[model samples]
Target chain A: MENKILNKLKNSLDYLSGESISSDLNISRSAIWKHIKSLKNKGYIIEGKSNKGYKLISCPDILSAQELIPLLKTNNLIKDIKHFYELSSTNHSAKELARGEINNGTLIIAEKQLCGKGRFDREWISPSSGIWFSLILKPNLPPMEASKVTQIAAAAIYKSLLEFDIKVNIKWPNDIYLNGKKICGILTEMKCDMDRIHYLILGVGINVNLEIDDIPDEIKDIATSLKIELNKSFKRSDILVKFLNHFEILYNKFVLQKDISEVLSICRENSNIINKKAKLITYNKEEIVTCLSLTDTGELLVKDSDGKEKLITSGEISFRI
Target chain B: MENKILNKLKNSLDYLSGESISSDLNISRSAIWKHIKSLKNKGYIIEGKSNKGYKLISCPDILSAQELIPLLKTNNLIKDIKHFYELSSTNHSAKELARGEINNGTLIIAEKQLCGKGRFDREWISPSSGIWFSLILKPNLPPMEASKVTQIAAAAIYKSLLEFDIKVNIKWPNDIYLNGKKICGILTEMKCDMDRIHYLILGVGINVNLEIDDIPDEIKDIATSLKIELNKSFKRSDILVKFLNHFEILYNKFVLQKDISEVLSICRENSNIINKKAKLITYNKEEIVTCLSLTDTGELLVKDSDGKEKLITSGEISFRI
Candidate 1:
């Protein structure tokens, strides 16, 4: 009965008088009050008194099941939304969720992560001031090839920031930077046998509203946020929606087109290290080399002082200003 | 007092006669019995009875702080050993253990994994029949370059099996196959920043003593074990020791040599996919191609029927007869 009243209210534009809803739906006034409370708990903004009835104001913009469901306009890209108020890590949760029979495009979002993580077991501070989410993708590729997803995510985040007219550069591997400070990071976790990848979780964290003080002093020099760079506060909801839409496009191209050259080209165009003097540090040796270009297969091209060119797929990059 | 007694036992070449130990150790017979029982509980094998005192026969080949301390002889490698009776996953445990202050070569081993997993969230059956372990590596390289460690591990495993006269073939990207069936798999998980790798966990699983029936039918067609292939049960403890020792050598080379061309050369020599007619399957397309050779950087060289050669870093592979 309460659901019926809510349905009527959702379909109608007029003010839903509580007493009228109670009488029309054949429910008690207290019952109407209880339904309104439940809808409010689910992020519905219902206003007005018991006698004056309830008025639907506005909904919360958080990425909860309640909010995300109505906004899921794409076909099969986002099949489900699993929201957590707090978790150890969104990537860990998404990995667990993917282990079950969850469909592709499953989105796992957490408001806060107790043990949020970055690449190499670094602690990621996700204290409700940033966007912590993981998307489940079943890309048609082998496990070794899953790194392309990280490149696609880097491209997507770059494109999203471009929409806001923000100049964001991609740091090779998978990081979005503005003015040499990291604004976003992407980690792609995959499962595969010898031949094929079964599923992948693209874990992304964007520092949307984090203040400079919120980030630790040690990394404050290297990490910046949208609010810090823009000198204005923007809604994380809008940023997340923009990122998701942009990600869907690049991801669709990646899975459907099988050609990552275009995506790679875009990433190279926005890459901060391309054509720059840099230091390449590996396990045993550190070479002072100049960044030449990125290969079509996603490898970094570097030239030594002797002008010898080398293709590097993995190593640390240090820009030599 | 127990430490003193253990130390004495370590020095003693002969099992002390019961009366002699009772007098020399200044402990009663019953006390000696109790201490011997405790040592046994800690996986020390003791021989002889109360009247004969106790003789140390052989220690259990288990991964423990005490057991591994004597076995660990490498510098800056095998700094610590964490053994678990059961865990969610060794890779997960190692990643967590590596989060705080940890030295390179910290090893995490589990006898059983309740939620053991492989790449892409696939369930990795890690019963007592396999060696399930993860090694924490702090290579001074960029995170994207961590794939070289996988190549090192593949080379190590291949070399170790050759020591036993076991004919094993490598299936790209990182699997060991015997008789055209997989016997081992490697998963390399790295934490990284945009520029450098923070740390990495190289998880390795090898089926040692499992019989044919021990494997599920669906996977039985694609999986094999040492015992099944050798027609005899082998000691898991021996294989584990050999693997660790072999891995240390390759790992040292990986860190000290920086370039993995030496390791990759060995890997290519053992890989069965080279010079074979193959089918490359990506998400968007499948093509019949001939394996030409392997790049020094580990990319596969494939020549399509149209006589066009391409270097592929990621895709599924199937050998065409």
Candidate 2:
């Protein structure tokens, strides 16, 4: 009853007929006014007088299901949206949710994470100025192939940034660089059977409106935010909406096409390390190698001076300036 | 005080030296006799006499840290051995322990797991008749190179099983086959930064003494236990000890060798599908390809009839035969 009254009040802002809203929603005029006051306390603005009913003037820049749902454009890519004011980690919550038979594309977004986690159990500081979210995807691929999801996500973020005319480069494995500084990171977690992938969670963190002072000194030299790079403040909600839209398109292509070599080709073109001299490091040894190409399965092919080509499936390689 | 007394009793298991045992541990004679009775109930056979000391005749076939520690031959590979009678999952416990300041080569062994997990979040039924355990390794490799750890573990298990004159075949990814049926599975979970791996938990499950009826009906066609294959009972402790020794040796080789191609070569030689006709299935399409070889970094190379070689990093491939 409260939701209906609130919706009517919000709709009235768009010049919705008050009489129609009252009759259609079967709510009293006084009840609508009361709900409007409640919505105001929840960071929603109303315009006009009681006689004209109400109009939604603005919404707080918060990550709520109500706020994100209206902005998301994915068909079924985001079946459900869960919002956490604060959490230990969005990945931890999403992992537990995945265990409970949640549908693919379920998303868990948090405004702040008390114990945000980075790769290798490192601490991720997720304050309100960043986007901290995990999306559940059940791709019909083997467990090993699950790495492609991360690649696709990186491409999606790259494409989304291209919309804002922001120059971006994807670091191999999972980092987004802007002006030689990392602005985003992705962590892909997967559960699989021997031959098939059950589900995967793509945890993404983006520094949006974070100020330089908000970043730690150790990472300040290496990390930068969109606000810092662009020298202007942008809406976090708008960036998220753009990301979801771009992700939906890329993800659909990945699922439908199965082979992301074309996408990989695009990523390689925009990537800073392709066809460049790089230092490859594995568990056993490190060597100076030349980047050859990316295989269809996303393996990085590199050749040594002796012309010995190696297909690297997993490892960290850095481009040497 | 009680643990010290138990330790003393375990060390002096020759005769019922009640007065000597009590004096050595500063415990009462009645308390010593009570502990002996408890040990008997838990499957320890002790011979005792009024004047003679206690003698350990035999022990029950249960996996315990106390029993496995002496059996392990690795220098620091088995640095810490945690034994659980039953737990949710050995992998979960091992991962949690790895998050702490635990050393590499820590092993977590469980006789049973109520919610044993497999790749892709599938449930692995680990009864008392199976060897359910996880080993923590902090290999100094990049995250991408961690796949080699899986290959190394599979090779070690295959080689170890060959010692028993069992004709075992290496299954692609990580499974050991005995006479065309799966007897063991390995799941490798890793924590890593972009450049380096923090730790990895390699969970191994082996069907040792399970009867045919013990396996679920759905998996019965694909799974076989040692007892079912060999038509006899084998000692679980013996196999565990052998695996630890083999793992330590292989891990050392992996860390010390300049390149992992030597190990990959062994894995390829032992693989059942190499050079065989197989169907590779991905989300987008399926193709019949001939298994060419495994790349040094662990990608399976397959050649289509058109003579184009494709490196398969992730997806399901099955033998057509």
**lDDT (Cα atoms) of all candidates against the true structure:** 0.77, 0.78
Model 2 docking tier (incorrect/acceptable/medium/high): incorrect
Please give, for residues A1-321, the per-residue lDDT of candidate 1 as tens digits.
544665667766768787678778788878887888887886778886645667787765566765565455566688878888899999989866775788988889998888988875788888787889999888766555677888988887877778888879888877889988998988877654334566788999999888878888988888888888888877666777777887787778767776687779888998998888888875456888898898897878999989999987666676643
B1-321 per-residue lDDT for model 1 (tens digits): 554466667778887776777788788878877887888887788786645556787776555555555554456667778888788999888866776788787888887778877765677777776788998887776544666778788888888788888978887777889999889989887654334556778899998877778787888888889888888876565666667787787777767766577778887888888878889865457899888777887778899989999987656676642
What are the per-model DockQ values? 0.15, 0.22
lDDT of 2 by residue, B205-251 (tens): 99999999988899887789999999998888888888888877877
Native contacts, share recovered per candidate: 0.15, 0.17
State which candidate has the highest TM-score: 2
C-alpha lDDT of residue B31 in model 1: 84
Worst window of 10 by summed lDDT in candidate 1 chain B: B64-73
RMSD values, in order shown: 5.9, 4.5
Model 2 lDDT tens row, A1-321: 655655565555375545666788787767766766877877787674656556778878887777777678878788888988888888889877876779998889998888887665677778888999999888876556667878888888888888888879887768899998889989887654335656788999998888989788988878899998999887777788888998888878877766586668766877766787888766556788888877777878889878899888665666643
